[model samples]
Target: MRVRGRLTWGRRARAGAALLACVVAPAVVLSPGVAVAGAAAAGAAVAGTPVCQVRDDRLREISGMVATDDGYVVINDGADDEALRRIFFLNQRCAVVRSVAYPSRPRDTEDLAIGRDGTVWVADIGDNDHSRPTIAIWRLAPGAAKPVLHRMTYPDGAHDAEALLLDADGRPLVITKGGSGTVFLYAPTTALRPGATTPMASVGQVTLPRTSTSNPFLFLGRGVVTGAASAPDGRRVVLRSYADAFEYDVPAGDVVTALTSGTARITPLPDEPQGESITYSRDGRSLLTVSESADQPPGTRPTILRYPVAAAADAAAHPTGSAGPVSAGPGAPTSVRPAAEEASGAGARPWALVAGAGTLLALLGLAGVLRSRHTARR
Candidate 1:
């Protein structure tokens, strides 16, 4: 099925909102105490170091990323231009080494995962409007010229998702992008087939606790799962939101159990303009992330940021078996803060007011632009 043109305009609106949050919010907010608290919290969290700048201008909307021995692999968030809808291979310097085309235009490719055998999986499961009949995963095995498409259907209904996890056995897991600190996980009930549609079953759900970590998207960003990665060793898995990365240990190779029952070690990633892509470093000692450059100034290139995993956490990594069955209970909170902070109450009233105003202005501008586009089409 072909993607509707309206989806492109919708993406533009979201990008504009992100731009405002990153560039306009901080400047308008003027509470001295709140500023200090925010700054202090930001400083305590180790920020990611710049590894390399993505030099290719075409890769401005990177949504999924995976690290390789030589470099990395990345995919854009379903661009309207068909020519830009390919899997990009980047060298260590973040330059495009080569690219492989998809067999057909993807609906919305949001995440990437690679297996031990060098098989690459691309998730085309993004349903921002919750209107998709079936989602798909594209597989590109080693030495293959093109990727094969595997269609999948969620048993309950359509849900928006941006994270995909591959277990030790190369089975694919899909994580929904839910609001209010809750997200559901799903896995195929049977093996995936390229020629036929596979049915997916809900494994369990995870609730990411609230954090006061500073981010461009404000309160709502903390709970949104934008991307995910599995360590090369298969002992750890990480899910990232716009604001932070949640890392969980996959003991005995039970990813669902780890996410459902275990507490994650939080790593704050503050102030990314439109962060979406994430992956583990080749040696699995650090996490790598990059943001989309669409909201940046002209000619700006996206930079790859590397955050070191704590030695204690790294030492605890162990090989896991095949992913076990879904466990009961919601994921426990690793760091709990008062929900009042989300509203930026008494301490951050000035900032909250300014931010809310900026958000409203951004939405108004986006509405005008979309209205114009519709008028022209008519």
Candidate 2:
């Protein structure tokens, strides 16, 4: 089965009108044993302490993440409802402040890229089933209402895209999510008209080892391939998967340079690795990864892990020479707000809770009093 469809022009304006319209297989049915094993090996390698757990039963897969002006926005290829596509907002310290869901059909959300002006772009480019004709991007503001989806068709029908990245100038670059991966450069001239998407210019391909899969039709097996990002200069790109990561230098002439390799020096994560997403902070000081456990029960929550750019880059540039394996804990720390402002930001929430409790208490007291009065009258 393949997803084939025609693209429409003026997609941006029509997005709002298409806002309202919107399942997955049984949990065990989709599980791949080999994929799980690969995740275990990778997890055992990255042995950092556990970070906080962002619990959500509907979160099936997290494709991408980007740091917005307000905080961090994490995107998930949610389960059940197509409308379940969610973008979670976190504060500077990684506290989730809010979330915005997009009104879209059930398509795979691969990754995200934040524009220079704070435009949140959610890329629905992950088509593992090969049933979608076209992919899309749901755009929204940092604190805006529901997102508006702008659908775009690839030049030659659908291809599984795992990475979504925008350069400093707001041009989109799509990374192929395949065993034999290729990087497609979408020039800024690539317009958003219906049926008008420019065919991706295949600039580079990765020579990597391939793994086995139960379904030959599926391009990417249980192994989730992701983490495509563009540096501030728009000349450098960073990419990674469950096992390996890489950095490339894009010269002004569009020439690409490889700066790091899969075995490069980097902090290791827990052994049960799944759900790999990456994004660079605006300040360029940090590269954050939100990972989910492959062995967790179907509805297990996700984890957001952060790696300092300097340390990670140092390791990525110097892998084998550096410590072969670092240690990471099983889970993350609890979500705790900053002390000084926690009282203020969290104060309003408690009042609503207090009001709810007070209302409940008052209702109970009234009911008891009425009962007593009825008995006396009787």
TM-score of candidate 2 on Cα atoms, chains taken together: 0.57
Return the top candidate by lDDT.
Answer: 1
Error of 1 at 189 (Å): 0.6
Clashing pairs in 1: none
lDDT of 2 at 118: 75
lDDT tens per residue, model 2, 53-121: 665543435657776566667766534444345777777555767777666453666687877667787
lDDT (CA) for every model shown?
0.76, 0.47
TM-score of each: 0.79, 0.57
Which predicted model would earn the best TM-score?
Answer: 1
Clashes (backbone N, CA, C under 3 Å), per candidate, total 0, 28
